[model samples]
Target: GEREQVDFRTSHRRKDGTSYPVEVHLQYLQGENRRVFLAIVLDLTERVATERELQEAQRTLSTLLTNLPGMVYRCQNDQNWTMEFVSPSCQNLTGFSHEQFVETRQISYGETVMLQEDRQRVWQNVQEALKNRQPFQLSYRIRTAEGAVKWVWEQGCGIFSATGEVVRIEGYVVDITQQRALEDQLRKTERLAELGTLASGMAHEIGTPMNVILGRAELLMRKAPDERTRRGLETIVTQVERITKIMNQLLSFARKRPAERQGVNLEVVMLDVLDVLQERLGKQQIEVVKTVSPQLPKVWADPDHMNQVFLNLILNACQAMSDGGTLSLALHPIDDTVELIVQDSGSGIPEEQLSKIFDPFFSTKAVGEGTGLGLTVVHGILQEHQGAIRVTSVPGQGATFIVSLPIYSEEVRHEA
Candidate 1:
């Protein structure tokens, strides 16, 4: 059978023996004298090349978005900020799959991930930025699907139509939790350095007077014949001695000596400190519990500094338990570092006071009973040795302090 018209696509060969794609069309034309067929060929080389280039660009874009360190999202300007498209990094950034974010199956980015207190602030900020047609940057905390809190930094702008109407919001979000922590630590270190300078100056100014008062009080006690007068002199001597002790602590805070670093056996140092406190522990009826891991590695630290560190901590534990309690101590290796855990079963610190415990002149003891520099000095010493200490406690339960120091290594020698 003959068809009125025929159309098909095929490859055409040139005289150079090179082939390119072509679209072919055939039409039949009949005349009274003769019958003839007409054919037309269209070259598709440019069209085919352009299609391939477009596909490659799309692939490149997809790869770049997938490997970004943070999530890339385009969402509606609605209350939930309902996502229209989200990058695969959503799992790592928000702990949710991209599919879930796109579908919003059971979670909404604004409602579920963002903190309740921050929801309104974020909404208002975005709206303000959109109103002005400008990009906005935000730093806020979000609770992840795992129930862990994290800090995030986001920068975004609105998608506007040709008529200048807002259509969508697109942004990138990255984790800043670690960066925020480092900044906070830097601030604390700066504050302590300033306070230490002030304390040192005051200590020097008061040191001579304090010593003179102690000497006068002792001389007066020796000269007094009446029992009441002698008792009064004794009280003066004791009070002067206490002030002297505080002055020495202030000087220590001001003049933190560089550590004489060496490989130290921390267990031996801890045991020696405990032995020195044994009598005090006995008097207070405080039971001691010790757990030391066998074959523990040595730590790169100063032996004397380690001794002072243990002494201050253990003595503090003893003071907390006036009615007698348990003092649990443990030592073990954690990865490349050694950890010492000190826990006390005494009148534990209040929750609100935990953060301030390491601050200078911050203490839980009654007036005239403490100088409040014990933990502050300990914190300074640990920082010098490239170590860290953290405390956990519940009011009336107990307090546990965890200290970590780097394990002895050849690199530590050069670094120290």
Candidate 2:
């Protein structure tokens, strides 16, 4: 048989029935009067198609990484300079384009975006990583073009050369601005709440002595000798009493007393409060109107706490009508509860501030005239008593506060 030589372009079907173009190169060897053809077949179709698909996928991934809402970069070891690639998202993240950062056109990578205060620390960390050839992670703020600041977190590992030298650093930066803002706000709110609690506690502790001082001063004024001495004593006593009153208000707002859980006559309590404020009402020419239902049921609460509640509310009503208007106090029996309504013709609370009126230290009175804790104390006391309070007001018209206390029947009292 004689050896043959062949040259061919062939199509081969794969396991999937897809035909690929194959080209064969053959060589003839004729050393011992014998010939052999060495064929090298190249399958070009599948590889070309796979390369096209891979390129398409890379383009899609590139588009996604570039348009993301954060910065992505690859940097070299020297001075932490960015090299090779930077995503276009850099503009959105740091108010600078990829070009400005890469070639150090405006500033070096670390200098361009890192906050001034953070720049030194950031570079120090990078230096350490390069020295040890380890991963680096950092969180810092960046100022954007519009003068707004945003928080970013960057995490990356160093790429080492064959000799274990840090060749490059690659990382992703993410926007953590919103999370940082929320954390800041929560810290501030907690601080404010803590201060409010402290203020309330101090006011309560200071009020008791102030009340005693005012009472003693008032008794002393009655025994003073000369007219001048008597007048001076009266002034001292009056001022001390005013201070005591304000302190009491602060205490009420700050330390809400727990209900002592005693049987209370709602009608009788309201009447006593009215009696205590009678002189002031008469001097102010403010009329006191009362509507008490005789059949009102007894309530279980602390008598003194309830007294404070009625005193604060009724006094508030009287004060609102500085120009001398009618103060209406109404008591009625609602199926299982007693409703006490205090209404006045004085200037009502502003709509915008009504919701915050019960918040401690929130007041509409001139500085030194009010402590802003009256309503807050009232709210706390009512809550302790398992009661509820509500208010309605029209600016410049009037305000109404309604308090509801659970009525205790004989059966309920026995059960308790």
Off by over 4 Å in 1: 1-9, 24-40, 161-165, 213-250, 293-298, 319-322, 332-337, 347-372, 392-397, 406-416
Which candidate tops lDDT?
1
TM, every model? 0.81, 0.48
Give a tens-digit lDDT track for model 2, residues 1-416: 44456778788899999888887777676667566677888987877788899999999988998888877788776653655688888888877777777665664656555677787777788778768777888888777766776788888888888998777788888899899877865664565457557667777577777678777767777777778887887787777777776666554534544446777998888888888888999998998888988767788778888998998888778768878998988999887888999999988999888767776678877676566767777877887777999999998889999999878767656655
Write model 1 residue lDDT over 202-237, tens digit each, in one string. Answer: 886788888888888898899999999999999998
Superposed Cα deviation of residue 282, candidate 1 (Å): 3.6
Q: State the local distance difference test value for candidate 2.
A: 0.78
Worst 10 residues of 2 by lDDT: 250-259
| TM-score of model number 1 | 0.81
